[model samples]
Target: MSPRNTRPTTPRSGTRQSPRVALTPRAAELVRRLRAEHGPLMFHQSGGCCDGSSPMCYPYGEFRTGASDVLLAELGVDGVAEPVGFWMSADQFERWCHTHLTVDVVPGRGSGFSLEAPEGVRFLVRSRLLTDDETRRLGPGGPSHGDASADTSAHSRSGGPGRA
Candidate 1:
């Protein structure tokens, strides 16, 4: 099967934790292709002014993340054993604390710095507010609620949302 043919691994009952972000069939395929070329990759939603406010894909470690950033989710790429991380600035997270984000792609140009620009497509975040049950799970601050780190078998190496 073409790498693109792979589907997002369906989350199974009693088997996996809810993902912070997910990919559509199309986005997953693109990621598979990009990973083959770029090596491991990660996503950072531009915090606003400085980074152009577009979700960008980068070779892990190519872009710098720090304490000011919040780890939103660690995504499982369809054909890759390693998970891709998704992050937002701490400030940006404040506005989106109640929403679930999905990393999707469309045909167009995104931030010039994002690795996919040359491919003529860009990644976008599709969001929805968390349900009451999900909010309860969150408790307050941090991932999957307070515990930003989880051993959900979804990350590239460290099974967590990757701290900046």
Candidate 2:
């Protein structure tokens, strides 16, 4: 009998896997363009209402985040030198922390506050719960950074909010 072949898919020693958030090819192209026109960029995931759970992109420092917000992951897009910050409401993150996020672009109108709205496309988030291995690799930190006093609410929530 022939011996069975086996190999592990895990990263080799000293190698590190990227965060849970990723950008689709089209999303990456749009992010590059937005970064060129707008400078630094950040993404916040909406829980519901307004944009309906879509990930909104804004120029860095435009939308303020607070302790009620959580930094899910930092996405490194192809050709973009700076990693994009991905945040969520602390309440929302509680529900989504175990899922992997993939930013994607689709045709149609999005929130005007998002940098991509005027480009005839909208940024969306495709998500799925993380696998056991991913959960282990990520370890256990839900929230990354947020100031205690800043308002976590944004335009995607009820009554609409500010852009910059």
Candidate 3:
């Protein structure tokens, strides 16, 4: 089967918590390729600035993240040595915390500064309303809310979106 047709692993039901973010199969494949060329990678969702709301890919640490950003998830892609951190602006997170986000890729030029722009594809976010269980798990404040350094160990090893 084509890799893109394969489904990402969903979280097992019951007590296991859901992940706040995930990557589509196509996105994972792109990440694997990018990692080979760039060494390591990280993603930050733009908060309607120069890049609008698209997810921006950068070489690890290329983008500065601080108190203004929220570390939403660490996506583990097959064949990649390290998980890719997914971050969002604290202000945007406040508006989006109630939803589950997925990273996907499409053919087009993105922000010139983002690593993916050179590859003729850009990363985008796909989101859905968090289920009751997921909302409760993340709580009203959402995972890691205002603190980028908050522990995200639970999401660090997850292969993809945590769906029952």
Candidate 4:
């Protein structure tokens, strides 16, 4: 009988690190669903363009480790993170540990979160800004593109016109 090939392939290394966020129940559900549908998603914060912070979800294909963060390890079948046990760049891990923002895995339309900066600053993005590719990659029944506008309208209705 011929011996069978039993060599295991080495895992790929140096993927972008997942951002840290406080996950609400809603956000957690969204992450679970995305992982099942797509390979993996990424979260990042960019401060160059707009004033308000933005959250973005990237398809596995578009994800990369660009001096920002590196994938540490898979967080079971539901999520991922960069801890000592996982394969992460030293800088990425250090940044995650020291960042003042708190990250959570909650139920949301996509696998990302927004923060309200300490000084009453808003850190979120509009659904309209999401490209069709992002929506599609996020999979079915996830947060729709109109959700951003809808959220603003709901807030306006509750706060009324005269309130600061």
The numbered model that scores best in TM-score is 2
User: lDDT by residue for model 2 over 67-160, one digit each (tens)?
Assistant: 6777665555555655566778888877887787778899999999899999999999888998887777776555465655433323223332
Tens-digit lDDT track for model 1 on 1-164?
00111123365321112434567767788888998998778777886785556788987656566556666666675566576666677778788877777667889887778999999999887889988866765555464211233222233245333334
**For each candidate, C-alpha RMSD in Å?**
7.7, 11.0, 8.9, 18.7
Query: For model 4, what is the error of residue 31's alpha carbon versus the real structure, in angstroms, after optimal superposition?
Result: 1.2
Tell me each candidate's TM-score. Answer: 0.74, 0.77, 0.75, 0.33
Best by lDDT: 2
The C-alpha lDDT values of all candidates are 0.64, 0.68, 0.67, 0.31
Q: Which candidate model has the greater TM-score, 1 or 4? A: 1
Model 4, global lDDT: 0.31
lDDT of 3 by residue, 20-39 (tens): 77777778888888989986
TM-score of 1: 0.74
Off by over 4 Å in 2: 1-17, 148-164
Worst 10 residues of 2 by lDDT: 1-10
Rank by lDDT (best first): 2, 3, 1, 4
- TM-score sort, best first: 2, 3, 1, 4
Candidate 2: residue 67 Cα off by (Å): 0.6
| Model 1 residue 36 CA deviation in Å | 0.4
